[model samples]
Target: MFYFFSLDFSLVVGIFLFFLFIFFFFLFIYFFFFSKLVIMDWEIMSFNGFDIKFTFLFDWVSLSFVSIVLFISTSVIFFSFYYMMGDVFMFRFIFLVFLFVVSMLVVILVPNLIALLLGWDGLGLVSFCLVIYYQNFKSLVSGMITVLANRVGDVMILLSIGWMVSIGGWNYFFFDNFFCCFWVMFCVCLAGMTKSAQFPFCSWLPAAMAAPTPVSALVHSSTLVTAGVHLILRFWLFLSNYSVVVVFLFFVSSVTMFLSGFSALFETDLKKIIALSTLSQLSVMLFAISNGFCLFGLFHLYTHALFKALLFLCAGTIIHCFSHVQDFRSLGFCWSKIPFVMTFMNFSNLALCGFPFLGGFYSKDLVLESFFFSSWSIFFFLFLFFSTVFTVAYSVRLTLYSMFFMEKGFVVDNESDSEFFVVFPIFLLGLGSIFGGSFFFFLFFVDFSEFLLTSFFLKILIFSFFFWGSLLALWLVFMDFSFDKKVFINYFFYYGSSMWNLQFIFSQFFLNFPFFLSFYYLYKLDRGYLELFGGKGILFVFSWLGNFFHYISFKSVLYFFSFLFFFMIFMFI
Candidate 1:
């Protein structure tokens, strides 16, 4: 088992993943163009009315997503070779990371609810282990938050499974009861929302930055977080039937996007800022899905995964080179030290802002254009508009603070980017960030000419927000307002930085309340009443009864002897 932890093992896994990516990429093309097929129910056995099968789904969606996952996993594992060097538990770390990837694959390729649970639970369990990899208090707490938030989703999925059992079997794809579909969709939406960190579940996404940078690059960017999006997409047919669910999802996603973007603008912790950015982008995916653009949402998912992974990898390089300084405030004038990483980071940041012709542009622009075409109310329009602007604002803020601004801070003289393991994956993902969007857009939508035929004015309206946000952020960042001195401004900063006190709510209400409730139960029930009445009470009653019986037995025996003697004398007489 230890042998699996070596660098050579990583090389082997990377090569295998690359091969799988190639195979699945072509498979996706074939399925998309030539034929669509699903291979189901490689049966194991049958219970009363339920059949357990290792059901595998192989359609264009699964194929394309699998290809992308394998590609990113390959890059991440290779990057980890250099990123996690000389670690004492390198073996355990590698094993857990691989397990994480496999779990994601299982979630992607299975349609059976029971089979999905296997993968779903695998993802939650393995993620908890990975998040707490550092074995510190902070990581443990973060891991707990991350896992518990996801466990809600797991419970929802389990409920959905039970609900599906009422219809016939665990196969959700073949569910026929329209009434049952609504309940399943509701449970699924809750599950997806939790896994994707929508709205109230949003705190864990930023907290999960406690994991190692490579884990963040993989888990946050593509695998763990996106599992929810993928799950919802699988249930899109059911979800589309319920306009109520779609409307609710739209509002939740919009709030999540706005909140995350707002929070990132004030976040100084570099990785948390990126994590918030990820949350915001995830909200964008959910937004598109909720607006009845499943394919568009999926397109964004693929594009975002590419560039976002690139961003995280670039951020990881920056953190690694600087002796793990993760605060953007302490990382000023970074370009002079690490120009390559800064360049890629800026590329990804621009892509994240949906710069024209970049990877994010293809999907993001379409999602916005489609929304504009819809007849939704003006409030949501502005919510989405400001959210997009906030994305650019934070991207510009991060790029300027880290690369251009001059501030007095510690600088590591030994920073180097010469390693092949590190540079190769970054370069690979960089190229993907540059062109992957257009490539996927072409494949996904051969002719988006209908959406493209909108007026030039409408087209430019979306891109214009990029400039507006960048200029706004630029002015704010470069100006000397002494903004912190003012009470109103200070309060705004505090609210923005704290996710509008959502963190406090999650920590106090969600996390602490459960712990306090459990402790109370332990005292009042387990230790107090249950102990007295359950085990101890039973033992005392048994002991007392035994003593009483032992004493009474001697007296009864003497009485019985005297009675027997009298009876025998009477009989003899």
Candidate 2:
């Protein structure tokens, strides 16, 4: 009470951001030592065999992930300054971005189940809000789907939490009880899948492109999508023991990778293409985790974040400079017009394709080598190879289509001025995309090596996938093949492009069924039976009783007394 003074919120935020930058930036540097440790613990409450606490683990895993998240988030915020410039609700937008960052940090750092759920929900809630921030019908629909998909994961987590109470609090690290652990593992993996947009849950991700591009850069890259990967990484210890769950995750991850790759190959919107690519990458991470190489999975998450963010930012610039044009067919060659955007876009795409020595090369190459060495079925091995090859194929296919092709006399939209604030962030992430993975590998994999059971032929086989995929992509581009009639040609084309009609299935089961049941209950139960018995039927019975007891007349009283006296005489005799 000695002094009344308050710090402005802006100043407080600036200070917080500055502190995080310095602390984590240094942690990023120092983590090369790989001295993992548990750093902090604080008890929040205790009662009746229930315990809750705030604790954090500082390991190479968390440090690496958190560092990248912080770095990408900062870049996104800077880019938003330009993307969201002159908007009336700019402050609200910025605030929501900050909330997203903080919640994601919670997801990354916490070791306890209860605390993790808080972050998980916060990420979902904030992302849904961001998705619908434009307040348009499309955005609303997209946001609803996104939120509902995430809510499925939230319910699974909640069920796990409820089960946790019986086992004493929300610490799942020491989850020894078999029944509890089994169900928890199953639910947790499903929750992770939904958050990561695996398989049937994949629709909402492309739809979430309705949000501003800056939000897309952050959400798709470092925050929302990666949260699922981080959750699985956190539970890797427990997950390793359950072979059934592992097998399930493996197959699911493989299918997701292939479907997303196939879908991305056919996608047209520039941002949607990047979103689908991000979906494919998430599947790659899950596949790595499922294969018991979680270290590599976490590594890929880090590397993917850098380039994926750059890809989105570059897309944002392209779309922004063209007055928000996203249709691939309408775009013209822009290398001469905006050298920076085109250069960085190609760099990110190259990295995405696992170009030699780039960011994606280290993790993806290692994953491929791992897959080659593992004793998987021919189907999995082939799909894994196809997914990897398709990653390159689509990267090449999309880049060449968008930036290298131009029809003469084509009119183009230009807003190079809007690229001013946007280009800087793209440039920064582009640098990371070029060198971030190699840097992490240098430090983290100081002694990294593997012994695959093969000769020169097998080694060449791995490298040949990339080359053949590029050749295929170039062939398609050169042929100028546009399969506009594919949908009409067969039902397979329609089903594949429409994500195997998963949206219809999800809508019917989760939405229409519930609505139908709600209508039935309201009409038949609430209004019909409940109303008849509990409402009108009770009132009629009371009214009839009142009429029977009505009138205290002398004749009525005498009749009642004579009936009672006759009954008493019959009983006594």
Candidate 3:
């Protein structure tokens, strides 16, 4: 008595086994920590032949990212305790925070595409929940759009998975197949571009600033966007195959970096500016990753997580202190009053601008070096260099205009003191931004004895140039560079006008396009064509003829013949 099973059964069993393994592992880890156990043993858990590993297998790459995610998340949670202390949705917020952490952990731990997709969609769901938690009309609207856009990426990921199965068979979704993987690689890369907010997909990130500052800190800086780059890094071997794809990725990243940096400079809203900067910095990491500098990209992601989260937390502190005023124009010199906040803010901004000796400087220089070595195209190098300059310029503008400079209309209420919880994370992140990269370098990559003796002159040159650029921006802002209003209007109109701008063009060219002939069918009132043949249109005629034949063939003859044959077989058996 043997039983035969279908492929579907095997699929179900495999999924169940994986699901149970993850569930029990999470439960065990939680209980171990909860029971105050100090287990020092490290080992890998295997399911079938695959290693379900834990420990310092969480190496340089994994540790760097995990630390950043957990640190930022912890900070956001701490800040939320203050930011939303008395709010009615405290329990809900905490739940979402935990959900986000769990999803991120799953994402980082899983080495298989199926597991990765589970975590990816789980994170998406959690983020959507966080976004719409307030349940306001604005949040609801933004949440819908954000989820919808993300779903497009999700579908792409699913298609990529299907392609993987079709091409490489079921066994090829793991780390071992990373090399020699092509179709799945391309689809996953496409999904990542959308998820990471590259170019056309970037509109949703800035719009997502509607969420609370703590949510912004966790979602924008530390976790969600970073996941996309993490995915690319996780499968670097696959991506390395298509050098053209890598170059295209670099180009998209460069465009996103410059555009978002410039947009940040022009933004009046504090959160929106930070949001745009997040997009720009993430693009920088993606560019680095695409150029075959996975470690450097991860390093930048780690450092940016710290500094950007601190920046947003500090911004949140200022916003809360000022009764929710977020405009730079309305914020004035508070260097003396909120000295701690200002210090942390300025430090983070300096890090963001890639100041020398800071963590950002090390990671950013590595990114630049990666680009420089990967190509001899001077135009590409120059584009990257100028983008860095613009990064410094906008960061300086943000710090100066908001914290140091005084505007006539700007005022601060005396009651705005930074809370310890909020200030603690800022201080921690500030320290990390100052020292984390060097510390990690020694611990993971090299000893001081093995460190290369590089040209200090180049470092000095780069630092001095950025410092000068920052000063130039400061001087320009102080000088109040003036333009005729008419000139500005002309420039705006000339460059910004597009098909997107013209309603008549959209109606005539897009709406009335003949390929959308079905749309006209909906509006047409004349049933002359239907009435001409008295409901016997082409489809109806075919349907009636088919039915008449079926009644004669199957119902009259075929049905009786099949029934008689089956009855005779049954009787004989």
Candidate 4:
């Protein structure tokens, strides 16, 4: 028995396995505790003689952003479990949600160009996938167009990378590249414009409403769309060199802000209104980034995520309850039936309107302050002011029309009450919109009071204007401003006239001409080649030559080999 025990190895293996289990159990416990107790430090880790640096630096900027993203994503996932309970493609939805979270985390973590591009592309891919997940042909087409348009901007970024490699070598993809990185900075800003859905590319965002509500919330608010603003903030130092690029960004952002806001004013679809509002709000962030108030931009991004996600989730609940009706004009007196949803949606709309003491007030004030200090152009200030007014106008219009106004022919049947998971996120996000900024200031050692005072009376003046604007819009909407066909026509005429002015002419002549010329050259080349070798000329020549070569080579070689073989055989015989 002793000899048998000595020879047996099974017990030794069992013991080893038991020890391994214990080790893994202890390791799991250690990591769980570490994740709870340890704050991620901003540091550089090196491997294979290459250094990768990142800051888990929970500053005012990163902390605010990361907290908002995680909160919104987690809430949306919680809501999805119930909202998508009976869905066939629930797993696919969750997969995209996880992918979005991972992409956003990567966007916030990596500190260099290559890593940033990785995150950027990842977000874009996830967003495009989510947009077309319903498998509708129209939605898929929109997603394809969005992907292709954004890829054009990505190409600029790739070119910028090559330019950086040429100018500063491979090691200069980090923060240090910004010191003299004007060209790369320009390319990156262009990329940001496309990613954030500014100007001509802004159409895709509104068209993306074919996606489910949760996807719209996640894409527009927290993760993918904000990647552009993240890129700008991550490379703020680089952008400072090209002040003209900053101004260009500002102009594009400002124009898109008002354009989308006004477009939202006319839109009746609940989700499209929200989508347009998102474009406008995102433009505000880009505007902040252009003005060098990156922290302010980040602050706005955090709050916007909270409120916008809340609004979208509430919109989802409404859509689900109303048998998929999405038009604000089609909804009437829903505030009484869906009290919780009404209250939360109002909070979100108010926050978006930049009401005092709300999240938007502070961030909007920061943007106004940045504009005042950077360049005191009256046109810029007025554009900001009018955009704010329009933002208020549309927010009130959406809320009032959807909740209070009674349509003559439309009646809503609210069959389902919003579940706990959906209501909980809305309440939480509303609460955050109220206090998140203050908490961020404390966490990051940021002196909000001083920063608030940095612009002195300008901030107060802007706040007053926003306040009055909201009041005026409220009054006008409540007074039931008649929709005059002539006014719309006149407004269209004004915009058309401005568009056809000098800028339009210049764009057509200088910018568009090159594209036309290239197309013409390609056309000429095709025509010339077709005329020179029309029909079957080249094919016939090639065929004739092939037959000649085949006959000459195969027949001649076979006959010569046969004769030589016969002669050898006869000699042998």
Candidate 5:
């Protein structure tokens, strides 16, 4: 039943995606080649009194993004058949994924805040379901954190919706002076940051890895994380004018990139490392968008989705084969057994490192090179540079741990590449990892006139980080830097492993503290004072009143009979 259901769903969505991809690919070409701009908005419905409409926007950005999303989602659905083969609730899982895809599409296609929230809220609601699919305590906690953090964004969007009411309608594109609404822009940016797992809301991304690997591939790559970037991209015209917000966004995103990359270096869990990298790449996209590199940011968003999805899928296969062990330290030389999966894994790892000509290189190079000539400060430039360096270092570290080191852990000899469902989807994404960047580069960067001309050294500045980062990785891998000093090790672990204490500060302090207070209040107030004075006290008061009334009624009946008897004796006399 599961196989049949999965196959049918894949076939249907695949055909639909194929035609959509071709249509949009040509549509993009038509719009770009002819140097024409077109935005087609269709109103599905119109309410009477208030005059609100359900509208869909079809433009080059929406079309292209929809195509990419469809492609990735279809592939993920197909891949889930293999990854989730043994699950009893395969049907539910597949449908949830499909619903997630629909929600993402809704978010991508709708321009109006009202309609966009429909999709935005759907993404959050469905993600909560998918994250806690395992039904365990860890998954539940992760799901709560993920949903609560995103709820902050949802509230912002809701506030933006309410703010938009003053302007007659919720279509932000209709008004040119939307930037004048400072609170609205603030809400939009905050919503995007929370959705994208920015510096403040980043703990959820790593925590969300408790979800199924397939969910991670889809959510972290295309749908949920990128939704924020897409939101900011749509509102860039208004957001760009807010200089203070833009500078703050730049700072936040740069710090996010650095912190996430740095944390990935100390991360031992395979899935958490990849999750942190996703957070880092997301920061890159937001940084570009903040710095007015929306074109490069959009380009990078597309390419990063392809490679990151591939990386997660590859990681999924490895984890599945290795008894679900996600620690790289416990895994080594996996290529010796599952050579084919490992081969594709390397392709994704290299792509993530932004190797020349791969999918990531085109966007990463464009964003970095453009930044070099921009008027931004040198401090952020260093932060981003080191972040890029850390990216490569961690990529190399991941490779060494998984490919070069001796097989130090348990071996499952039953691993094989015979699963057609597994290899086929991976092969498709692998091809994208190899050529998706170049294809997207031509389509998107046809006219990079805004990129200032720079010297040769400046041209390869981003490329040079790869070399230095690799050297750092090599030193860290080969050197005996293990510390015997307990305090130093504690501090190192505290800073590195805890993401500069963001996990505790944000997760434990900000979120968990409030939750703890609630629990304490439940114990001290609801279970203590409120329980006595409120529920139990009311019950006791009612019970006492009932007894008092019964005794009064009995006394009244006896007195009435005595009075009647006395009246009857007087009448007889």
Candidate 6:
């Protein structure tokens, strides 16, 4: 039933994504570990003072990041075989997935701003199409929100392109020596946030759970949302030259990390919680970019994608089996329903929490170690430290609340993976989530000096945050801690759950006002006022004048004039 088109085509494309992943991985290993480096450029336009070109700067950063994207996309496509096995429009969905991957590749490959927009806008457009694939009210609304939010980024990119004219061309790297164009880089960073779903643009990420799970796996995990961090990393050369932009980016990203992490704690819906987790991880990448560790950010991005995509897929597997039970409150004892899914879920959540030797461990540890040595402020360290703790807290809470307890709606089903298409892809990704970090760590960081350089206390403190956070979560959930009334009653929890009223401001206040204005103009001006004054009123005046002219014809006027003239002449005589 799924084969609207040739299944062979899907298999070929899926294999290709994996092939590209391996190809890039080998290339990255040679470049970073060995002596050979591959820096290829394709020029398209040459003009006054600058040329518009497509340049793939295949340093450790781009290659590694793109490898991660391709790897995750490959797995997502494989997972989709089971997820959409019987869907009528499976062909359309796969096509969109392929297109989305292509667009992301465009974003990843290009260094020029104008050329980059081709991919950037492509990601936005394709993501919108994918999000509304379900064609329901929720999907339509979510897709509209996604499009409008991404449009802000799309518009900013166009503005960035316009601003680049002052710098001679869209090739930002060419201006490395004369890096005074903060505004240009600033525009790019601003655009990045919208794509990355930072802060104000964040509501769309969770709302986009309305999309199919495979789309979520690709869109949230690696391709669409990561475009922002990828763009910022590409522009890091210019961004690092300006402290103001860095400060602004740092502030925004730190708050985003905290906010999303906090919000995940409040979220009950399984998919939405996973979506918020993606937001937090995206923020971490943004924060790393702001600190001028763009390469380090890229490393985290790579590792995060490995696990987060798997997490989404695992959630999809369970959601598929359960059908409608996405709420953790009612989804208790999932460990009983599918022990294997429970295993995948726990591993992913643990990876997300940066458990030792997992995919997240290597990158998260490096990023944290780097932060301590960077000599940033104590408050900065605190915010970051606590954000990590928040990650652990919520991850633990999610696991315990969903797995450890037995609720009224709990079901116990022992389903084997013999017929499940997800098993292979999930197992492959699970392997990546465990070993990809260590594997990439060799290609990523040459100097392990940073790891040993930090003080023992600082390292302990970092791990302590995770330990304490996890313990507190266990206490809160398992101890009958009255989490619902106590936390929900508090302002922070309430605010966090409501996503800090950001939805209210965006959806109700900002969005509604524009809609109100549009309605008023459509009804009051175009239909009513304009119809009366511009269309109907003008027609009425012309018709009345025509009638008046018709009543007094030209010949009748002449006869009346002649009679009046004769009468006047007789009177005068």
TM-score of every candidate: 0.89, 0.84, 0.73, 0.73, 0.88, 0.86
Please list all clashing residue pairs in model 4, or write none if there are none: none
The list of candidate 1 runs beyond 4 A from truth reads 1-5, 46-50, 407-409, 413-415, 448-450, 478-484, 517-573
The per-residue C-alpha lDDT of model 2 at residue 302 equals 85
Residue-by-residue lDDT tens digits, candidate 4, 1-573 = 433342232234324433543553454345433543222534468788766654332233443455567677766766665566556666666767777777777777555566557777887788788889889887886676667667867787787777766554432335363444777778888887888888866766766787778888888898877888887776777677777888888889988887776676666689988988898899999888787777678778877887898889889888877667897667778777788888888888888887777767667766767776775478877888878887887787787778777743434444445566666667777787777655544543354555645544675776676566667557646444555546765575355324223224433334466767877776765555664486455877888989976775677987667767888999999
lDDT string, candidate 5, 292-318, tens digits: 889889999999999899999889988
Candidate 3 global lDDT: 0.70
lDDT, candidate 3, 392-499, per-residue tens: 877887777776676434345444455666666677777877887676555445545633344776557566658766875685465444454466644543332221
- Colliding residue pairs in candidate 1: none
**How high is the CA lDDT of each candidate model?**
0.87, 0.80, 0.70, 0.70, 0.85, 0.80
Off by over 4 Å in 3: 1-60, 166-180, 407-418, 447-461, 475-573
TM value for model 1: 0.89
Question: Is 3 or 5 the stronger prediction by TM-score?
Answer: 5
Candidate 6 per-residue lDDT, tens place, 294-378, comes to 6678878888888988898888877777655787766677776677767877888888988989989888887787776576798
Best candidate per lDDT, number? 1
Clashes of 3: 0
Question: What does candidate 2's lDDT look like per residue over 7-113, in tens digits?
Answer: 13323443466468668868866764756466577778999966567988777678777878878876787777667765767777778888998998888888778
TM-score, model 3 to reference: 0.73
| Cα lDDT for residue 313, candidate 6 | 84
Model 5 superposed RMSD (Cα) = 4.6
lDDT of 4 at 509: 38
lDDT of model 3 at residue 233?
84
Predicted candidate 4, C-alpha RMSD: 11.4
